[model samples]
Target: MSAAIKRYGLGILAIAVTFIVFVVPLLFMALIAMKDRREANRLEFSWPTNFSLVENFQEVLSARKFMLVTAFINSTILTVVSVAILVILAAMVAWVLQRRRSRWNPTINFLILSGLIIPPAVIPTIWVLQGLGLFKTLTGLIFIEVAFGLSFCVLLFRAFISSIPKELDEAAVIDGCGPIRLFFRVVFPLLKSVIVTVIVVQSVSIFNTFQNPLYFLPGDSNATVQLTLFNFQSQFTTAYNLLFMNILLITIPPLFMYLFFNRQIVAGMTAGAVKG
Candidate 1:
């Protein structure tokens, strides 16, 4: 009984600490978003004297003439397309690498691993894109995001695929199944759990990505949600209330996604760690 009590106490303490560390900051940000410009400058912990969520949201929405909405749409498109491509390509490549053991497999693995270590050369990438007439385009940014995110996704998929028995593939092949059909019909369905995990994790990261879009696809016309934060900053001053509101707006979607998919993400991430 004493040991159980001690464990319960520790668990409660840990929960309290987590709430203080993570939840408190989110609550504070929400509070600031609810405050007026002057109250936000004051940055008090107390409840707002006057709730201005609608007002601040209107200002943020109206800023740059509804450019935030456009930016959100751009981010949604980039994140969805890039993550979908990453998952499909990574799963296929990892499946091939893991199932087919050959002399070249090690070399290919090494190259994929190199992506994790190598820092992308921004200028060279830009120059290459310009040479190909893809610079300053959404497609260019989408491709870049995919390339940047592929290594980690591949690693995850490869690890997950490794745990799946090779006999499944062999059996399918013996049944006269081609590689493409076998993968889609037999193997891909089994990967649903890990794929959901990758989708959730990558979607959130890509949606919040700031630097790639800023450098590769700058300007209001092609701005992403993260880049839209710049609209709140100016040469002379910054609108803290509106900025916080925008931050809050940008934060909610990813937060909701994680909350909704938390179980799938955890399961997928841990599935390989324990088995593979």
Candidate 2:
């Protein structure tokens, strides 16, 4: 009884804290988004009298000649292509690193893991991309996203892959299956949970990212959803209503994705923690 009380108490406290920290700010943003520009500019925490949500939504989407729509299309393309490549590459690399035993394993692991710690050398990357003729292009940004997101996804995949049995590998090999066939046919299907987790988590990360698109793909036609926030913000005059509405817009897809895949995320993250 006492333990139950303590657990429930802690859970309730966490809920309250989360509500205060996240929900309050989100509610404020929604309120401002629903207000007219004049009331929204006041930035008060009061209920709005004149709701202009539809107006602001339309204006935000229509701003700069439907740039938000274009940004959405660009962001979707970036997220989908980059994440697909990332999943396949990361999975293959993690499978090899986990399954194979080599003297160079530690060195390889260190090199790959270093990507997580290293700050991107933007100017050098740009120079290299320029030499390769990929600068200021979606292709360049896609590569950047893949490189930056690789280490974490590899770690997740490696952890989950470890939980898979070696017996399956041996059985597949004995049955005349090659390495690629073994992975794609037998082992890959078992990775559904972790794959879903990686897809959801990395999708959110890539979709919400700002600086990569801002620096690499500066062309307005290639703008990402995050870059559309600049439409409402400027040097002097800021459209607060439209700004919050834009925030409301960009925040929805990821929020829905996370909520939908919440269970898969937890299960995948904990796949290898307990070994029988």
lDDT of 1 by residue, 1-276 (tens): 999999999999999999999999888889998999888888778799999999999999988879999998999999999998998999999998888789998889889989999999999999999999889999999999999889899988888898899899889999999999999988899898889999999999999998898789978889899987888878998777888899999999999999999999988887678666
Residue 270 local lDDT, model 2: 86
Off by over 4 Å in 1: 1-13
Per-residue C-alpha lDDT of model 2 across residues 42-160, encoded as one tens digit per residue: 99999999989899988998999999999999999999999999999999999999999799999989988899998999889989889999998899999999999999999888998
Q: Any idea what lDDT model 2 has?
A: 0.93
Q: List RMSD in Å for every model shown.
A: 1.8, 1.5
| Clash pairs, model 1 backbone | none
Model 1 TM-score is 0.94
- For candidate 2, list the clashing residue pairs, or say none: none
The lDDT, on a scale of 0 to 1, for candidate 1 is: 0.91
- lDDT at 272, model 2: 76
